[model samples]
Target: MSVTPHVVPGQYREVSDANGRVYRVGETDRSLLGRPRAWMVWLPWIAMMGVSVYEYGYSSAEAVLEHAHGWTLTETFWIASIWAVFQAGVAFPAGRLRETGVLPARTAMLAGAVFSGLGFLALSHLSNPYVVIAGYSVLGGTGAGLVYATCINMVGKWYPDNKGARTGFVNGGFAYGTLPLIFVFNYWFHPSNYKMVLDLIALGMVLVVAFCGMFFRDPPKSWWPHDVDPLNRGVSEDARRVAKRLAKNPPAKGQFTPMEAIRTGQLPLMWFALVCIGGVSLFGINFQVPFAKSLGFGPLVAASSAGVLAVVNGVGRAIVGWLSDYLGRRQTLGLVLVVAGLAQFGVLWSGQAHNEPLFLIFAFLNGFGGGAFYPLFAALTPDYFGENNNAQNYGLVYSAKLVGGVGGGGVAAGVVAAWGYAGAYYLAGGIAFLSALITVFLRQPGAPRRSGDGSPVAEVGGRTPSPAEATT
Candidate 1:
C-alpha cells in the first residue's frame, strides 16, 4: 500500500495511506512557550539581594569603626577583597553543580541564605578582626556566590528571549535591597551598642533565608506562558536537518555542557568583555562611599550617597535590558562602554572641582555606566550559547567581575593612599576608557535578523518558505 503526506493549518500533520485513513506526526497545539512557575523563582533572588544589602551595612560599620576603633585602611580593604575573592572562586563551581542538576535551584538558594545569616550572626559577636574576616568575608562570600549564580541562571532560563531584561530585574533587586537597610540600620544602631547592630543583621539574614526557602522553585520545562509561544519555536526544520547531517550533531536538548563552551572562541571573547567592564565597575562601587567621605562629606551623607548609587545602579540595569531587546547585543554593549568611559572621566573632573552639583551628576553617570554592564554580560552568554548550560557559562563569565572587584578595589585603595583621591579617580577613569576600547572588537554571534522579531520560520526538510506561504 502507498501513503501520502498532508500539512494541515495549525493542526496535526496528516499522512494518508491507501486505506483512506491518516496518521498524525506533529501536534496541533502543543505549546512552545516557556513560562516560569508563579513568582516563586523571583523570591530567592529578592531574599539574596536583601542579604547583600544587609552585608553593605558592614562597610558602613567599617567607616564608623575607623573613627571609633582606629582601624586602618589596609584592614578594611583586606576584609572586602577577601570577601570578593571567595565569591569569585565559589560562583563557577556552584554554577556547574546547578547546571549538572546535582542541586535543585531552590535548595541551593536556601543553603546560601542560611549560610549568609550565620556568617552575619558570627560577625555580630566577634571582636577579633581575623574572625570577622573569616566568618563574614569567606563564609558570606560563598553563600553570596551560590545565591547569585542560581538566581541569574533561573532568570536566564525563565526569559529565554530577553535574558538582559530578566537579569537586569534580578540585579535591580540587589540595589533596591540597600535602600531599606540604610534606613533600618540607621534607626536601630546606637553608638554605645555597636554589637547589637551585628545581631540585627543576622536576624534579617535568617528571615530572608526562611522566606526564600519557603517560596522558591526551579521552573518546570512546561511552565512557560501561552502568550510567548511565537518566540520559542525550535530551529527551522532545515536547520535541524543540517544540524543532524553534521558529523557532530548539536548537543542534546539541555545538554550543551559548560566544558564544551569554554573550548569555543566565543567564551574567551565574552570573558574579556566582562573583565573589562567588571574591573572598572567594581572599583567605582566599592570606593564611592570612601571617596565621598574623603571629600569632606559626613558619614551620613556618604552612606546616603551609596544608597542613591544603588538605586541608580538598578535603574541602569533596567535601561540596558530594554535597549538590548531592540539593539543587537554587541552594539548596545559598545554604546554603554563608551558612555561609561565618559562618566568615569567626568568623575575625575568633578572630584577635583569640589562642586556638589557637578559631583552628583558625575556620580549618577558613573553609576549608570557600571550598573548597566553586568546585565548585558549576563544576557549575552545564553544568547550565544544555548540555555542548556546557562548556569555554568554565566558563572564562568561572572568570575571576571569578581576579579575586577578585587583588582579594581585594591588598585583604587592603593592609588588613593599614595596619590590621594584625585589620582585614584584619574586611574579608574583610564581603566573605564580602556574597557570601552575593547568593546568595539566584540561582534554579534549570529547573523542579523528582523528588528524586534524573534521568530525565524523555515520549512521542514526543505528551504524556508515565503512569509505569505508560512502564514497560509
Candidate 2:
C-alpha cells in the first residue's frame, strides 16, 4: 500500500498516517526562514530572560517597593499576585489570537516589549496600588505573557522531533536570568534610586525583547524536519536516534483540537497538576526572601538564596529536560514534583531552625524541583496532543498558572499573616504532593497502557479515545 501526500503548493507537502495525523515535510528551516532553526531557541531564550524579573526578582525588590510606594507589606505582595494573574491569564487568549492569525508573532513581541517597559515605569512612578495594578499588573503582565507564551510555543513549533531538551533550555532563561538583578535589587536599590533602577530595567527589557522578536517566524502547520521521515523509520543515524526517542515518548495518535484534547480528560488533569505545582513554585518565588529575612538572616543570605534558586531553577530545567528524553516525560514529571514537595518541607525546617547553610541547600533543591516541571508540562502537551495546534493547547494548560499566581502570591500573603510562615509552607508542600499524585493518572491521550499483568494493551490502537475511555 502506497500513501499519497498532498502538496501545499509552495509551502510543503503534507502526508497523513494511518491515524490521519498530518506531517508537512520537505521544507527546511533555512529555506523558509533564511537561517537555521537554532535561532528560534536562542532568540526566545533572550526574550524570556528579559521578562524573568517580573515574578522572580520581585521578591528582592519588595522592601524597596513597599518603602518607595508607602504601601503595606500585604499591598506590595498583592501587586505581584495580580501581576501573576494577568501574566498567566493572557496566555490562552494570546495563543488563540496567534493561532488564528489575528496576532502576528512580531507584533506580539513588540507589544510585549512596550508593555513590559510600561510595567516597570508604573512600578517606578505609581504610588497608588490600584493604578499600579492597572498599569503594571494588567498591561505589563499581559505583555510578559505574550512574550512568554510566544517564545515557548515558537521553540516547540520549530523543534517537534526533540522538544524536551530544547523547551527546557529556553524555559530555564525565565528563571536564572534574574540572578544579577536579584542582587542589585537587594543591595543597590533604594527609594531615591529605585525610580532610576526600575526605569533602566524597563529600557533594557524593551530592547532585548524587541530585538529578538523581530526575527520570530512560525513554521508551517504540521511541519516536520525535512531530513527525518515522521511516519516511517529512515536509515540515517540521526533518524535512528529520533526513532528511539519517539518510541519512548510516543506522539499522540492524532492532532487533537483544543476541544478534543479537553474531552480526552488529560488536559484537565494536566491543568490541575499545574495549578497545584505552580502555586507552590510561585509561593517560593514570592516569599523565600522574606522568609529568610524574617529569621534574621543577613541581606546576603537572603539574596544569595534567591540567586542560587534562580540559577539552579534554570539549570535544572535543562538537565531534567534532557533526562526526560531518556527517562520518559511522565515519569520525570512525577519525580520532579515529589522532590519539590519534599524541598518545601526542607525550606521550612531550615528557615525555622535558622540554619543558613541548610537553608541555601534546600533553596537549591527547591529551585531544581520548582522550575523544572514547567518545561516538562510544556513538552508533554505536544507529546500528548499534537504539535499542529500546540500553541492553543499549551495556552489552555499554561493558563492554570493564573490561579496558581493568585493563590501563591496574594492568598499566600493572607495565609502567612493568618497561619504564619510554617503553616503557609506546610500548605504549599501539601499542594505539591497532591500535584505529584495527579501525575499518576496522566496517560497519553490515545496511546498504549500497561495491563494488570504488566503487558501492553492498546488503549485506543492509535485512534482518538472517547471521554469515558480516557478517564479510565
Candidate 3:
C-alpha cells in the first residue's frame, strides 16, 4: 500500500503500509508560502536592518567627534566598547522574552528604537565626556542590543527553510543601511558647528525609527509560504495528524515548545558558529574609523572611509546570500572565511605602505569578509537547529561577538597608541585569519541521504514552512 499526503479542513491524516516505516496515505498541506503573514514578518526584518544602519551612523558620529572635538582615543574607545557591552548584557534576556512570547516582537523592536533615538537626542546636548558615555555608551548601547536581538530572532522564525538567505538579507540590511547615512552626514554636518550636526543626527534617527515602526509585525502562525515543506521528515503521520488537529482548534499556537530545543545538542554547535563569526567581524567594524585615523586620514576622511566600507559590506552580504542559496551554506562559509583571512592580511600590508588607494582596496576586501561572515552564520544556524529557538540560540552566539568587540576594540586602540596605525591593522588582520582557520573545523550537521534511485535532495527546513502548510 502507498500513502499520499493530503490536507483536510481541520487536520492532517496519513496511513502506513504493513512496513510501518513507509507511509502509504498522508495529508500534507502545500501552502506554506504566499501568505499575508510572510510579508508581515518581513517588515520587522527590513526595519531591524534600518535600525542597524542607524547604530552604525551613531558610532560614526562619535568618530567625527573624536577628530573634530579633540576627544582622546581612549574616550572614543571607551564609549564604543561600553555600547557593545551593553548590547551583550541585554541579549540573553531579550532572547528569553522572545522565546517565552512575553512580548510581541514588534513591540520589543519599537521600544528599542525609541531608546536608540533618545540616546542620540541626548548625545546631541552633552559637552562633557561623561555625558557622552552616559547617553551613547550606556543608554544607546542598551537600546541597540534590544533591537538587534529581537530583529534577528524574528527573521529566524519567519524564514526557517531559507534561514541562510533570509537571515543574510536581514543582516545585509544593517551594512547596506549605512550607505544613506554616510551621504546624509557628509552633506549635513561640518566641523565648525558640530553641535548642529548632533541635532540633525538625532532628528534623523527619530524619523528612521518612526518609519520602521509603521510596518513591523510578528508573523502569524499561518503566515508561511505555500510551496516549502517542513524539514522534520521523520515525524510520524499520527503525530502530524495530532498537530494539525491541535493547530486547527487553537490556530495561533505553535506546535513546538522552546524548552525542547534548549535541551538539544544542535543549539550549542549553532551558537558556536554564530559567536565565532560575530567575534571576528565586530572587531573590524567597531574599529574601522579609528584605524583610518591612525593611518593619517583626518576626521572627515576617516568618517567618509568608514562609510565607504559600509557600502562594500552591504554588497558582500548580498553576494554571499545569493551564493548560499546555490552552494551549500558550509561550503560557501568555508571559502568566505579563507578569503576574509587573506583580506585581513592585505589590510595590514596596505596600512604599512601608507598608500590611500591600497588602504581603500584593502578596506573593501576586509569589509566584504566581515559583511559576508555574519549573514552566512545567521542562515547556517537555522539549518542546523530548528527555528523554534532561533532567538535564544542567536542571542547566545551574538554575545561572543560582543565580548570579542570589547577586547578587540581596546586592543586595536592600544596598538595604535603604542606602535601606530599599521600595527593595529596588522593585529586585526591576524585575528581575522585566526577566525578563518577555525572555520575549517565546521562540518555540515547531517550526512546526505539518497533516494532509492540514489539521487540527492538538497537540504531544506532551515527556513519557515510556507503559508499552505499553516492553513492546512
Candidate 4:
C-alpha cells in the first residue's frame, strides 16, 4: 500500500490512502531539502512574537504614551480602541489575499514589519490626537493584523494533524513576548527617552519579522503528516501515537470555502461569543494596572501585577492548548471563560481590600483566561469550518475583538466614570459567564444544532457525519 501523489501540473492532484479514500492535494511541503521542515513552526512562531507587542504589550506603556503625548485618559483609550478596530478588521481581507496567493506569507510578514515600525514612530513624533490615531491605529493595526493572522493560519496549516498544542504555543507568544518590554516600560522608560525607545522597538519589529517571514509558507489542501497513517498506523509507533491523539479531534470532512462556512451558521455564534470574551480581556489589559494604582498600590506592585498578567497569559495559552488535546476544545474554552469571569470578581475584591497578594493571584488567573480563548477560537474555526479557508473564517471571528476593544477601552473608561471599578468588574465577570454559556452550544457546524429538548435541528440530521460520510 504505497500512497503516491498524482501531480497534474498547475492544478490539485490526487492522493489515496490505504482505505482507498481519495484526497485532492494542492501545493505541498516538498522542498529542495526535504519533506518536513521544522523552521515552518519556529519562523511563524518568532514572527508572532514580533507583532505581539502591538496589542497585549501596550498597557505598561499606555501611561508613558499618555504623558508623552499630553492626552487625557479618554483620548488615550480612543487611540487604543481604534487600533483594535483596524487590527481585527484587516484579518479577513489580508487572509483572503494570503490564501489566494496574491499576498504570500513572506510578503505579508515583510509589509507588517515596516508598518509596525511606522506605527510606533507615529506615537513618538505626532502630537495631534487625530494624527496619532490615523498613523498608529490604521497602519499599525493592519500591519500587526496581517502578521498575526498569517502566523496563526500557518500553524494550523502546518500542524493540521495536531493543532492544539502548536497553535497554543504560537498564540502564547502574542501575549507574553512583551515580558521584557513590560519591565523596560516599568523600571527604565521615561517620557524623555520614550521616542528613542519606540524607534528602537520599531526597528526591532522589522528585523525580527523580516527574518522569520523569509521562511513562512502554507501547506497544500487536505495536507496531513506525510509519514503518519491517519487511517491506519500500521507498524510505525510514532505514527500510531500521532494518529491516536488526532483521532479525538479530526479535521473537517472537506475543505470549506469562506462563503460556505458562513452558510453553516457557526461563524456568527463564534463572533458573538468572542465579542464578549475579547472585550473582557482587553478591558483587563487596558485598565488592570490603572485599577491597581487607583487602589493605592505602589508603582512596583502595579508594574509587577501587569508583568504577572503577561507571563501567565502567555504561559496559560500553551498549557490550555495542550490541555485541550485531552479535554477537547469546547470543554477547555468553557473552563477558561468561567475562570476568567470569576477572577474579575476576585480582582475587584482584592482591590477593595487592598490585598496585594490576592490581587496578584487573581491577576495571574485573569491573564490566563484573557488570552486563552483567542487560540481556542483560532483552533476551533478551522476545526468546525475546515482548514482551507481558515484564514477567512477566523478573520471573521477575530474581528469581534474590534467591538471588544472599543468596549474595553473607551467604554470601560465610561463604566469607571459611572458605576466605578466594582460595577465594571461585575459586568466583565457576567460577560465572561455568558461567553461560557455560549460555548456550551458550540457543536460541529455540519452537525445538528441542538434544541432545548436535546432534539436535533431537522436539517442537520442529528449528528456530525462520520469522516467517511464527510468525504466526497
Candidate 5:
C-alpha cells in the first residue's frame, strides 16, 4: 500500500530486451503524479461520463429535434450518424497528436470542452442541417473523440499491469453516463424548452472535461509499476497475481510501431472485428428506442428500453472487462460476440411477437452484448502490441468505428426503410456472429509456434521466448 520513492525525478533505471523495447522502471505512481495512480482512473472515468450524453442520450431527443429544426426523421438520424462518424474518425489523428507531444492531454481536453460546448450551441440555435452538421457533428464528435481516446489511454498507461478491469470501468462510464439525460430528454424536453436544456448540458460538459483534464499527465514512456517486475516472475504475492494474468493474457512481445503492427496482420484483423461489432453496437443504440416506439410501445416503455440499454451497456463493459482478466481476452471476447449475436435475434423475435416482458429481457441482453467489446479491443491492442505506440496503434484500430457509425446509423436506416426492422436486426445479428468467428483466428502475433513434438519452437530467438519477447 505504501510506495517509497525509488527513482529520482526525470530519471529511471531502464530495462531493455532483445527487441530494443525499453521500460522506465523504478517509479511509483505517487512519486510521479504526487497521488496514487487510482486518481488517473477516476478522473478519466468522470470525464468519459460527461460526454456520453452525446451518443447514448441523443436518440431520446430525436423527435423534439426534428420538430424544432423542421427536419425529417431521417435528417435527425443523420445528425446522430454523422456525430458518430466524426466522433470515431478523430481518434487516429488525436492519438497521433497526443503520442507525438504535439498535443498534451490537458490541452486536448480543454479544446474538447470548448468545441463540445459550441457543438451543443449549434444544435440549440441552428436550423440549417448542414451548418448543424458542421458544428454539432464535426466539432462535437471531435471533442468527444479527444476525451474518449485520452481517457482510455490514461487508464491503460497507468495500469498496464492490470488494465482490463480499469479500462472497462472507465469505458463503461461513456455509456451509462447518459442515463439521467435519457429520462430528461424523454419526459422533460420539448421544442419549447429544448434550447435551454441543451445549453445547460453543454456548459456542464465543458466544465467536467476541463476540470478533470487539468490533472491529466502521461507517465514517462514505457513506465512500469515499481512493485511489479516487468521481466522476472517475482515470488511476492502481488507478482504472483500478475504472473497468473501474464499466463492468461500476456503483454506484447515488443513495442510495435503503427506500420509494424499493420505488417503483423493482427492490427487489420482487430480493425475489421471492431468495425463489425461496433456497427452492431451502434445499430442498437440508434434504433432500440425507435423500434420500441414503432412496435406501439408506450412512451415510458420506449424511454425505459433506452435507459435500460444504456445502463446495461455501460455496466456490462466493466463486468466483462474484469471477467476477461481471468477468462483470457480471446475467450471472453468470443463469448461476448456470441451472446450479443443471439440477443439481436431475441430482440427481433420478442418485438415481433409483442411480448413486452420478453422484449425487455432481450433488451437487457442486447445492452450487455452491445457495449462490452469496446474495452476488450482497447485492452487487446496493447496486449498484442506493446503500449509505447498504443495511442496511435489503438487509434488505428478504434477508427473502424467511423465506418461502423455510418453503417449502423445512416446505412442501417436505409436498410430499415427497405426491409423494415426485421431485415436490419438480422443483418446486425449476422455481423456479430461473423466477428465471433474472427475471434477464433486471433492469436498473439510473433508468439512461438508449436513444433511437431508439442514444444515451443522459437520464432524470433533461439529459445522459447517470454510473452513480451515473442513479437520482435
Candidate 6:
C-alpha cells in the first residue's frame, strides 16, 4: 500500500443522547493506515515486547552485574527498585501530554528509544553504583515507562470493543518478550563479555521501539467503533455483543478530566488496591527464583521456576482478558487476587516441604494470578473513567506501581532481613487478601441512577426529573 502525506486527518465529532451521555469520536488509526491488516495493534505489541526484556531479563543477570560493578545485593536491588520508580512515575505525565496533543505518542516512543539506549550504555560503562542508578534507573526507567504507557494507551484507544482481549494480548508481550534474553543471561552471559551483551540489548531496544512506535497513534477520545451501534438493531453478532456489554457497563457519563476522576471516590480505592497487588507481584518477580534456589532445588528446577513464572505470567494475561468479556472486569480481578494470595502461601508450603514439583506448580499459579490482574486494571480504568482522559486517569492508577515497586523490592528486602522469606511471604499473602477484599467496592461512580420506572438515567441538564422508564 502506498502511503500518502496528503491524506487528511478525520474531523472531530460527538454523539449525544437525552440522558446526557456524550461520546467524542475520531478516525481510527486503521483507516489512517488504509486498514492495512491491523498494524496498529501489532506495532504496540512488538514495541511492548521490545521494552520487556529490560525489566524481566535483569534478574537473571543480577549476579554478573553485581560482580562487574562490585555492588552489594541491596545496592543492586535498590537500582531495580529505583528503576521501577522512574518507569511507573512517568506514566501519568506522559499520558497527560499525550492526551492533550502536546506530546505525540510516536515522539514519546522515539525518545524512549534514545533513553533506553543510553541506559544500556551506562550499565556497560559505569562502575559507580550511584551513577549507574541515575543512568539505569532514571534514564532507562523513564525510557521504558514512555514506551510502556504509549503502547498500552495506543491499543486501548484502537480496540475499545474488545479491549480486554487486545489489552491482554499486548500486555502478554511484556512478559514473554524476555524469554530469549533470560536464556541468554542464564547460559551465555558472563562478566568478561557483559559490556558487548548490554550494547547489543540496547541496540535491539532502539530498533524495536523506534520502528513500531513510528506507526503509533490514538483513536480520538470517545471514539466508538464505526460498525457497532448501541441504539441500532441488526448489527453483526459481534457488534451486538459489544453493544450489550456497553449497556451493561455504560461509557463515562462525560469525559472527566483527571481531577474529576479523583473526586469520584473510587480512584483512591483503585490506587491502594493496586499498590498492594503490584507490590506482591513485584516481590514474586524479584525473589521467587532465589527462594526456590534456597530450597535445595537443582539449577534446572530453579531456572525452570523462574521461566515458568515469566511465561505463565504473560499467557495468563491474555486468557483472563478474554475471560473478562464474560465474567466482568471487577469480578475477574477479585478472582485473580484470591488466587495470587493463595499462591504465596502455596509457594511457602512447597518450600518448607522441599517439594520441587509442588514448588513449580505454585510458581505457575503465582505467575498466572500475578499478571492476569494487569489487563483487568487497564480495562477497568476505561470502563469506569471513560477514554477521553484515560491516559492521565490510568496513569494515576498505574502510578501505584511506583510505591508498589518500593514495597516489593526495597521494603521487601528489609522484611526478608528481619523475618526471613517465609515471614515475608506470609505478609505478602496478607496484602493480597486485603486487595481482593477491596475489589468488592469497585462500582463505576458514573453509573446511571434509577428512576421510578426502574430505568437508569442521569440528570445531565439539571432539570426536573420525569418518571423512569423500565430497564433491564
lDDT tens per residue, model 4, 1-472: 2233443334433444432323433333563114455666677778888877777668788888889888988888888889998989989999889878899888988898888888988988997999999989999988888889889888988777678888898898888888888878877789989889888999899899888887776766556554444455356676676666666665565456777677787878889999999999999998899899889998788888898888889889988888887778888999999999998999999889999999999999999989998889998888787777888889989999889989998899899889999999999999999999999888776632333643211111224444444442
Best by lDDT: 2
Cα RMSD (angstroms) for every candidate in the order listed:
9.4, 6.9, 9.1, 6.6, 5.8, 6.2
**Candidate 5 residue pairs in clash (backbone atoms < 3 Å):** 253-468
Put down candidate 2 lDDT per residue, 356-443, tens digits, no spaces: 9999999999999899999999999999998878889999999999999999999999999999999999999999999999999999
- Going through the candidates in order, what is the number of backbone clashes in each? 4, 0, 37, 0, 1, 0
lDDT of 5 by residue, 244-357 (tens): 887788888777778889988999999999999999999999999999999999888888889999999999999998999999988999999999999999999999999998
The TM-scores, one per candidate, come to: 0.78, 0.92, 0.75, 0.89, 0.93, 0.90
Q: Which ten residues in a row have the lowest lDDT in candidate 5?
A: 454-463
lDDT of 3 by residue, 257-360 (tens): 23433445444554555455555566567666656666786656666667767877876776887677667666778777767667766766776677777877
Score residue 72 of candidate 6 by CA lDDT: 81
Which rank order by TM-score, best down to worst? 5, 2, 6, 4, 1, 3
Runs of candidate 2 with Cα error greater than 4 angstroms are 1-11, 447-472
Superposed Cα deviation of residue 466, candidate 4 (Å): 25
Question: In candidate 1, where is summed lDDT lowest over 10 consecutive residues?
Answer: 246-255
> lDDT order of candidates, best first?
2, 5, 6, 4, 1, 3
Return whichever of 1 and 6 wins on TM-score.
Answer: 6
Instruction: Identify the runs in model 6 with alpha carbons over 4 angstroms from their true place.
Output: 1-13, 24-30, 232-235, 447-472
Model 5 residue 453 distance off true place after TM-score fit, in angstroms: 30
